[model samples]
Target: MSDSSFLNWPFFEERHRVLAAALEGWCASHLPVDHSDVDAACKGLVAALGAAGFLQPSGAGAGEKLDVRSLCLIRETLARHDALADFSFAMQGLGMGAVSLFGTEEQRLWLEKTRAGKAIAAFALTEPGSGSDVANTATLAEKVEGGYRLSGEKTYISNGGIADVYVIFARTGEAPGARGLSAFLMPADVAGLTIAERIEVIAPHPLARLKLEGVFLPESALIGKAGEGFKLAMSVLDVFRSTVGAAALGMARRALDEALARVQARKIQGEPLANLQMVQGHLADMALKVDAAALLVYRAAWTKDQGAARVSREAAMAKLYATEAAQEVIDAALQLHGGDGVRHGMKVEELYRDIRALRIYEGASDVQRVVIARTILGEAR
Candidate 1:
């Protein structure tokens, strides 16, 4: 299913290849075939991923910088194996990404526990009103004696109800639009906070909406500075966005694999489905998309690892193309599966659901296009 030849490309190191192979073997033997108890399954997956040392790539330990190529490889492998597994791993990296990139000594203490799977983590930036328009943040954080009193709500937060700590964004009145926002490391059990709703999605892994009436936090909770949240958020997003594309590329590869198997194994009108020219065309197209997407995803990741200041444009292009390409690839695979594709418990059915969300989360496709165009046109978003 995987195009292993891509691993031989200059974008990856020998260490990354070793890590990918090790994690793939671990996932094959350990990851559950069914996540009937989605919550428990997620917890278990996190613990397993951590214990196997795969989670170490998250760079949660002190003084360790994340290797984007390693992150991309793990994501691609995990997504190919289990969607929930990939989500669990991704949320951990994202929830702690801010701290990993910019947190002070005390602020990053929890990374040990988070990376060890002893503590759950969440990144709470999206609101009911603003998803991609991060500048329009509505969640208010008012200055108080000891710290800030946070009020307002955050919706569609990954690992929301379950997270031990959240990297939260809120408006602080220091400025307007994006500058007014601040990032905080808030504990889930803050006195004035509540998990207002536990959302159920087509593919779910602990999504929730939260309300903070007057949550109080110490001044030490801030990540970077008050007016620096927007910048911090963008930096964190830049690192993870390309990995999202890698995950999509993985799913697309799996879909192509499934399509190839189905076409060759199934018979139609006294002949193999693989024998049909039309089926061959679909297979060829699927293969092309998967490969092309891989090139973009790894290119962005490799560029970042090479110490470029920011790979924003490359990241956006990778995410936009890979996610959209994965959707098409998965749909084509589902089409090849015919009746069995939509049937419950089918792998292709699950892949169809799994691939849809990549386009929407971590900056939607439309938003990515705007970002790419802005970068090319010498403008800012």
Candidate 2:
């Protein structure tokens, strides 16, 4: 099995190993359909995941919860089986992570409800003009008599149209950058909050552009201190970005497995493809990349679990290497499959689309490079 060696890695403990096995077992029996209905598929996956109790690791209870190592392991395994499954699981944790990490008592309650699959959650930070530049956000929130009135648009939001609650970042002060921003927990029922457009991508999911037109939020909606939204967003990303790499690692592993199975069973030049030196070389490369990606991903996750408040450099490295590596691995797998790889609804074909979004979201590969460089320079100074 592709997972045989992954369990022996030092980054994982007995619990992680057990969780991986259990999730794999569950997925074998309960995996969702491989159809094209992205939104319906995601909702079904979410409900199934929640019901199966797989969402717990991502949505642990308040105080001393959510084993990061286990979360990564689950993502890696699910991603190997189904990319949409990974998305359904990862977003549950990330969409509500800020509340888990920095929210008030009320927010904690909201998180608990969402974690239980009673509601959907979302994180809204990206605007049309501000993909990687948080400081340049045009979203504005003006303090009203008893609350704040928010006005702006956020694009590329996962679970946007369906989320029951959103952690939204907006400029609260007239100051020019990230320092002027703040975060608020806005309910989907809030006045003037609308889904402007549903976005379609290479691998469609429930993504949308959110428009807030003078939406008034109670003072209690604020999360963390005023002017700390950027920091909060970054902190949440630091914790979750490595998991993205873990998901990519999962995809790469599955792709490698698919290639291996196909090559061993199919004949090319008067023999099994696996007997060819070129095929062997490609398999070796895929194996090496999958192992290396797993190590980087788990290392970052382990660092965060070991009480590091920030894992900027490590997370960036993990995300950058694992995601890019997964792309290469998936491409090689596709090559090994030849025409079958590109066949509609094929596992490798779906993975090809699934892996593309990882590079663009959380932070783009180029943005991650900038982050790593800046962190290195700062440490040196």
Candidate 3:
């Protein structure tokens, strides 16, 4: 079993431990769902997670803020059992994060069905021309007679095709660059919004390219305010970025577990592989990566829960280190598994594919390095 000792760490509280235990139990019974049909699997997982109340923490009621520690712990645990489960749960929070953090009472009402898993949510910020350049967002949201008309294409949107609602960032021309963006809560059924294409990745989830051609929304659909989309999107990322690291930590832990078992079971030179010093060294390195990643992940989460306003530096560090470390740990685990590691059904093989996208999404490792550097430089100024 993966180490439960991390729960005893001072970074967590009694209630956090309770949540971890309860989620672990629930995952043991319900996870590793069929993936033959990835879309169907995600839909079912969301509903099951909602019915089980595990998804409650993804959203907050009025006057409540998201508990960062809880989000991280749940994601870590879910990822350990099934990466898809983690995706399903994480998207619910990220997809609707803007609503939870900045929406009006009327806008946030959608949280009811979202948190209940009856409705799916999506965040649409990345566009065809801009990936990390939030300021370069080209999607235009033109003020209309009664509402706004959005015209742009968004690619690599999570839950893009399946989501019931999307929080789209578009240029409102309030000012130049980042300052001119605005956010809107657009329903997927809007007349002008269409799924341009479905993207297939090494590890499958419901990802899509979306085309919005004059999609119209009433003024009430505005999230926070016009010209605040950049700030709002950053704020939402501030909360969810650390959780990405938590998911990586979970995958690393699973890789370590699989490695430990492989080392003990496989024999070499007529002795168990665990007896070999070289093999033990690999095992040690894997364990070290997992622990180090966990520490950074939880530290970021705990710092956010302490109400730091923005944990960008900490979250960037956590996301960069944990994801890179998990990639190494999973690679080592696969190497130890010998040729079986490359086989289609092996857990390590699945983890290998699963961990790659973590390093790229949320924020690429190199982008995180830039974030950390910029934060330190700005502080010095």
Which candidate gets the maximum TM-score versus the true structure?
A: 3
Pick the winner on lDDT between candidates 2 and 3: 3
- The deviation in Å at residue 294 for candidate 3 is 1.0
lDDT per residue, candidate 3, 128-172, as tens digits?
889888899999999989999999999999998999999999999
TM-score of every model versus the real structure? 0.98, 0.97, 0.99
- Model 3 worst lDDT run, 10 consecutive residues: 357-366
Off by over 4 Å in 3: none
lDDT of 3 at 299: 94
Clashes of each: 0, 0, 0
Worst 10 residues of 2 by lDDT: 58-67
Cα shift from native, residue 243, model 1 (Å): 0.8
* Tens-place lDDT digits, model 1, residues 1-381: 466888899888899889988987898897644688888888888888888778777754566778999999999999998988999899889999999988889987878778887788899999999999999999999999989999999999998888899999999978879988999999888899899999999876799999999999999999888988999999999999999999999899989888888999999998999999999999999989998999999999999888888999999999999999999999999999999999988889999988888999999999999999989889642
Error of 2 at 236 (Å): 0.1
Model 3 CA lDDT for position 140: 93
Clash count in backbone of candidate 3: 0
Clashes, model 1? 0
